[model samples]
Target chain A: MRGKYLLGILVILGALGYMVFGGLGRNLVYFLTPSEYLQDQARYQNRSVRLGGLVKPGTVQYDKDRLELRFVLTDGVAEVPVLHKGTPPGMFKEGQGVVVEGRFQEGVFQGTNLLVKHSEAYQAPKEGWTPEEVRKLIEEAQ
Target chain B: MLKTQTPSRPDALTWVFLGLGLLLLPLGLYLALAAPPDVNQGYLVRIMYLHVPTAWVGYLAFFVTFLYSLLYLFRQDPRHDRVALASAEIGLVFMGLALVTGMLWARPTWGVYWTWEPRLTTTAILFAVYLGYFLLRGAIEDPELRRKAAAAVGVLGFLNVPISYMSVKWWRSLHQTQSIDLTTGRIHMDPAMLQALLFNLLVFTLLYLGFTRFRAMVAALEEAKEEA
Candidate 1:
């Protein structure tokens, strides 16, 4: 009976230890914004990191191979040039948020791939509205 | 009326296992502290010392469940069924530790807390399926039926363990592959670190056995009380 009680106590203690120390296991990666990365550039240089921001307008350029691409990722304050070797996703466009993973080399962020983030407010077009009607409504709202 | 008393004999195997567990603590500590940091990953790689051992022991516990579940099905012994259930509970605890430690290690290395990588996702599913085993056992009232249902789940859940381990190799995943192979005695680590990891593995295995046996004993006692 005493042995059983001791076992119960040990199990309870183990459970409690898990609850307290478990956070160390869960939050392994800390997210950083563009400005945060810039502020700590010296410490983070040459290390693998993730950069997330909007694809700056008028900065996208595609190569002859159609697979190689370049774009500028901006967080309104500064823009970082990105060179990617793979094909960009369909939703990857100007003014869209994207997260790229790679190392920062020679002041340029060379990304291996791009993940395009879609907005939550996407709405389907009304069934009754024709293109002409929708154009008129847009004109009136503007 | 008086009850008859029989001579009680202590289980020597349990004591030996417990001694082995005690001996491992210092070795695991030595490995964690003595090994030089990795040239590329640095101190973060030390997390592997604890994480890998926990994962291995979790797999060991599940294997025990699979064997006992088969025994229960063939022999129709409630004792084997109780042992299987107790082992599953312990297995869940160790698996939870593995998942948590994997996440902690990933954050400093992978640049994200969670990813949709194949290995990580499959392990997560494996954890959930085993958790469901406990819930299913609780919801059923008939003891015989519960044993049959739980045995089926135990067998099926064990099948996922291998798939989780191999998912990294079989699919595209950001998670890294296994770093050490014990069978070939081929390990890539600072000598001190390898020693620490092996020590911790032994300690954790002892802890797993101790807990499972204790849990089984408690389960048996509870059943005896119910029968009374």
Candidate 2:
């Protein structure tokens, strides 16, 4: 009886293991810096990829009416123009480090998700001190 | 039915752990909430004091479950199975807290409540796996069979833990990588913020220790009662 039960358990485990490990290749989206993504443009085009880089200074443009955001992502060596359809995250700003996830298409990275990667250093507001004075407290903190 | 063995009771060490948790947890919370705001994150960062620590402890709890489950399999000891159950119960609660807290943190910072990011999705899967473990236990009535099956799950569920931790690194997760790196001994934070986070980690670790011990004793008493 124990042997029979053991065989059942083994078969069940084999199936579960196959599902998890087998699906990993399709499920995992690779993270790449801007340069890396550019280095292999053909491989990533039309495929979901996370492009990590700094938000190029003076490159962020937002249309509040349409909720469309456009920015340039740079790894200092290469820059990719990203067009996103959403409100930028709280910490997003020019010169901020960010990662955009979407597909590279027609000379632009069309982003479906936008995330700001904040600096590790915890610094205080430079001049104005207000838990209230800020328009959007979350955005200003950055 | 007469009792043959004394039901387990928490010993002095349990008291010590409980005492330390009671003492330091509040202090840690005070430091976390009342502490100065981060330059970049401001008041929103307070969530980390709770969110990060709960996640750390939650992961630790599941790790305990995994360890005890492996031990139970090796020795075929019901005592180890009991320990695994106790730890997993605590772990489940911690994981819930981590998920909820992460959601709360995401709203203000990420500009949205939830996303299908790798870290979040993997963690949700982990949460389901552990929940399934408890359900699996209840579904099996034969003690030995139940123990064998649950132990397998208890071990397999642990595979998600490492994946969750490394998700931010392996994939481009919106969730940031861990602030404190135990592997390289690198901590990313201001002194005060790091201090509060470290204190909370300590308190939560003690709390996990004490809570798991109390839970195991209760499990032992339950088994004794069932036998009697």
Q: Estimate each model's TM-score.
A: 0.61, 0.81
- The prediction achieving the highest TM-score against the true structure is 2
User: Model 2: residues >4 Å from true position, as ranges?
Assistant: A1-24, A30-50, A102-106, A119-142, B1-16
What's the DockQ of model 1?
Answer: 0.02
Q: Write the per-residue lDDT of candidate 2 for residues B1-228, one digit (tens) a residue.
A: 355564577888888998999899889999887566766677888888888888998799889999999998999988899989998999889989999999998887766677666787778777777877876777677889999889998998999999888887777666777778766677777677888888998999899999998888898888888777
The collision pairs in model 2 are: A123-B39, A124-B39
- Tens digit per residue, CA lDDT, model 1, B90-110: 999999999899888766555
C-alpha RMSD over true interface residues, model 1? 20.1
- For model 2 chain B, where is the 10-residue window of minimal lDDT? B1-10
Off by over 4 Å in 1: A1-142, B1-12, B182-186
Instruction: Report lDDT (CA) for all predictions.
Output: 0.70, 0.80
Show the colliding residue pairs in model 1. Answer: A25-B104, A28-B107, A29-B107, B31-B196
lDDT of 2 by residue, A1-142 (tens): 5555455555545544554565444446535888888888888767888788899998889999999999899999998999999887777878887877799778999998887766545644445566555435655444
